[model samples]
Target: MLKIEGLSKTFGKGTLNEKKIFSNFNFNVDNGDFITIIGSNGAGKSSLFNAIFGTFLPDEGRIYLDNKDITYVPSHVRAKDIGYLFQDPRVGTAPNMTIEENLFLAAGEGGWFSIGQKKKSNEFKEKLSLLNMNLENNLKKPVGLLSGGQRQALTLLMATYSKPKLLLLDEHTAALDPETAKKVLDLTNKVVKEEHLTCLMITHSMESALSHGNRIIMMNDGQIIYDAKGKEKEEQTVQGLLNLFKTKEGNLMASDRMLLEV
Candidate 1:
């Protein structure tokens, strides 16, 4: 239930350093659609999320969520409708805040601690218990003390704590070890399925994009160049997709590990 029409952005306008990030970008996300965005560095994958999440207002274009124009909506206001998790797990949780406390303050659902003792601890414990990862017992633990995977999984829970309409994951598993990343990715998939959350996930690893999401989109020069889903994506190898880019859009040089990581 999101749409982007004629979206474009550029930096350093009217100067020798001018760089245009995207041009006439367009895409529509369906209810519960899990879209994996894959592209190399400087490809505008993260920029697109920032643009959508209100971190950066594009020089031009319109962003709509459920048909309401949110082009100028401040990031804080948009937080109620959209959730973003950065590549760094630390970005999602407050290290100094206890697990229950962090969830308590998420999206401003509870009263201020001084207003009245918020009674969310029990409800939050029940929710965390569903993770089957012992996070329920660590409700009072500082998020910074968690392992990378745990923090990422907890961040997943935090992003959805308020049930935002859409979730934006920007290379959320990149920093973890392969095993930890897989665990976090699995947690992400489970949560999305359980909640029926519509999501946009940016990733460099083609394997991840193909393995986890229902759809995969290939982007270049700040525009979507290839879009496929489900069985359509299943038949192709990662190398096949890379070659397709070569044939259709010319060679795009990205890291070898990035190609292999997914």
Candidate 2:
């Protein structure tokens, strides 16, 4: 469903601070695939998502979604086809907007007149009720008033409300407390499974990577070092992944946060 070919990206190209992220990277994601990606800092995971989402175009290569080339598409235009959830709950939401208003915008239906329509509003409540966050009754409250976990849950609902062709989750639960993070993760899995979303998630926790998703990929220096799926992914353990990286990608340092999580 998604393909990247000959992708290359560099920051401050040809300057003293020039840094290369991706280099001739090529990968394919099948329809209905849920991929969990794990790597240390500066591994190009976020850059890959940005390149696909058109936050910035890759210096080389083409990105195709459902066989349509979207490499040069503007981010706002791509936003319709691709849903992205950032690590920061505040990033994707309008802090001052009421929850109802935010959902109205995310639904992308009629104008302001449609906001309070009973039919659409009921649908919103049904969706919100699934989060079990007591948000359904507080639709008029500003999103800024919600907790971190609640805001992230709302963002997840917004991102998937349209059932976009692809979803990119960038360490979306990393900011929440452990209990809250797990709750959000459970909610995320529910949304992705129910929607049958083709998703790629970047995570620092090895346990989460192994437990979630149909497939797992290990990335380093903009390269995919390992890819596992099905029985292989199920058989893997968190420590095993760490050992593999240590033995196979010698001298590469996983972030302290990653190590601690394991």
Residue 246's C-alpha lDDT in candidate 2?
83
Instruction: Kindly provide the TM-score of model 1 when superposed on the true structure, using C-alpha atoms.
Output: 0.92
Highest-TM-score candidate: 2
lDDT of 1 by residue, 1-80 (tens): 89998888888889999999878888899988999988777778888888898888887789899999999999989988
**What TM-score, over all chains together, does every model reach?**
0.92, 0.96
Report the number of clashing residue pairs per model.
1, 0
Which regions of candidate 1 fall more than 4 Å away from where they truly are?
Answer: 107-109, 112-119, 252-257
Candidate 2 clashing pairs? Answer: none
Expressed as tens digits, the lDDT of each residue in 54-166 for candidate 2 is 98888999999999999888999999999999999998889999998899999986675754578888889999999999999999999999999999999999999999999
Best by lDDT: 2
